[model samples]
Target chain A: MAASRERIREVVDRYVGLVASGTAAEIVDLYAEGATVEDPVGSDVLKTRESITAFYSALEGLEQRTRLLAVRIAGGEAAFHFEVQTVADGVTYTLAPFDVMTFDDDGRITSMRAYWGDDDMTIG
Target chain B: MAASRERIREVVDRYVGLVASGTAAEIVDLYAEGATVEDPVGSDVLKTRESITAFYSALEGLEQRTRLLAVRIAGGEAAFHFEVQTVADGVTYTLAPFDVMTFDDDGRITSMRAYWGDDDMTIG
Candidate 1:
């Protein structure tokens, strides 16, 4: 169990690094084949790997970076708080998001739910 | 700074304990006199201790319990994921909420924002 917890933590750290480096293709590889993502809690779940890959591809063009503020892992799941900085239309924006993710026995993310709303974004 | 992080972590633990014990009044006391809360990200902010107290009072009649899933603290802020179990009208409901909170220098919670939606609830 302890080893599994450590692996989940490593996966989370790798996620941050990959996002900061703009390696979108590599990011998708960290998830299991049928992983689902529901960003912003109330939104529709994105289930297809193709759609998930495309969702990450959108990040490739943006000058974006992520800084992890906090992380918690337990019961084969992890939750983290992070701040994302991005530039769009020459304006810098900061977004704070809290994400809860569950992993399978193989340490691949099976499901991810991000919690954030427009109110959590700030223009810099 | 480290001491402040420890204090914040302690406060978060206290919050979980108080909620589990059904001590709603004392839970509100963990906040500063004028702390603000937005339990659901898109909801209107609740300001003033009286209003906050009343909001918590609503918890008193429910058979509720909280189990901490994860906690992270940094930069005078903390975010945690937890499961809330409550019985209403003889039905058991489970809620999963991710909360981000900022604390004042005095170790009191200055602001709390909970991220959850209707989709996050499960009835048993």
Candidate 2:
């Protein structure tokens, strides 16, 4: 059976929460083994589980919070607008990216492409 | 030269405004000659200008309004969350779709895929 809309919404919520507080390993677990991640869209895609883990690992120890501003799911895929605020060395950086993801039947993410750029980030 | 971030944002704003009040021909002028549109994502793509124009023509005489809730542009591409409210026969239908679009250096849209399912729509 195809992934249900409820299931997809649950996963999107979980993903945002994990990005805020869970370990990188925990976030990586949400994806299928061969999932691909292309955060910031124009960047190189991270294809292997190891690389994907590394990508999220960068935030493992950061002081950050995330909010899912909005999400639209259709045909086993979701496009979400989310905000990530990170504080380091007494400065806060905020970026809201629009991410598109496709999921497998089990609701595991198959691919993710995030749309944001340097110009979108604001520092305070 | 690549499309600038400001240009992309301007285009996004114009596109939303056009959806709300412009004619099908006016909206089609925002695309390149060979642009493609796949509204609601899993549907058949409209590749030619004629087909794309036909798709938007459905809204020509409708009592409708649109709002751009959010948009993120990166790498000459944009993903936007927008709301469309239509009233017909004394009933109002509202649907918000997350649309992803790629543009050329001239800021003309090259392709678009909208993400929204029947479950996301509401009637009042």
Best by TM-score: 2
Question: What TM-score does structure 1 among the candidates reach?
Answer: 0.54
Clashing pairs in 1: none
Q: How high is each candidate's TM-score?
A: 0.54, 0.93
- Per residue, candidate 1 scores C-alpha lDDT tens digits across B11-117 of 99988877767556798989988899987754779998888888888887778878887665544677788889998798989987778788888789889877666
Q: Which stretches of candidate 2 lie over 4 Å from their true place?
A: none
- All models: lDDT? 0.79, 0.92
The C-alpha stretches of model 1 lying farther than 4 A from their native spots are A1-3, B1-124
Q: Residue by residue across B76-119, what tens digits does model 2's lDDT show?
A: 89999899999999999999999999999999999999999887
Tens-digit per-residue lDDT, A42-122, candidate 2: 889999999999999999999999999888887789999999999999999999999999999999999999998887899
Which consecutive 10 residues in model 1 chain A have the weakest lDDT in total? A69-78
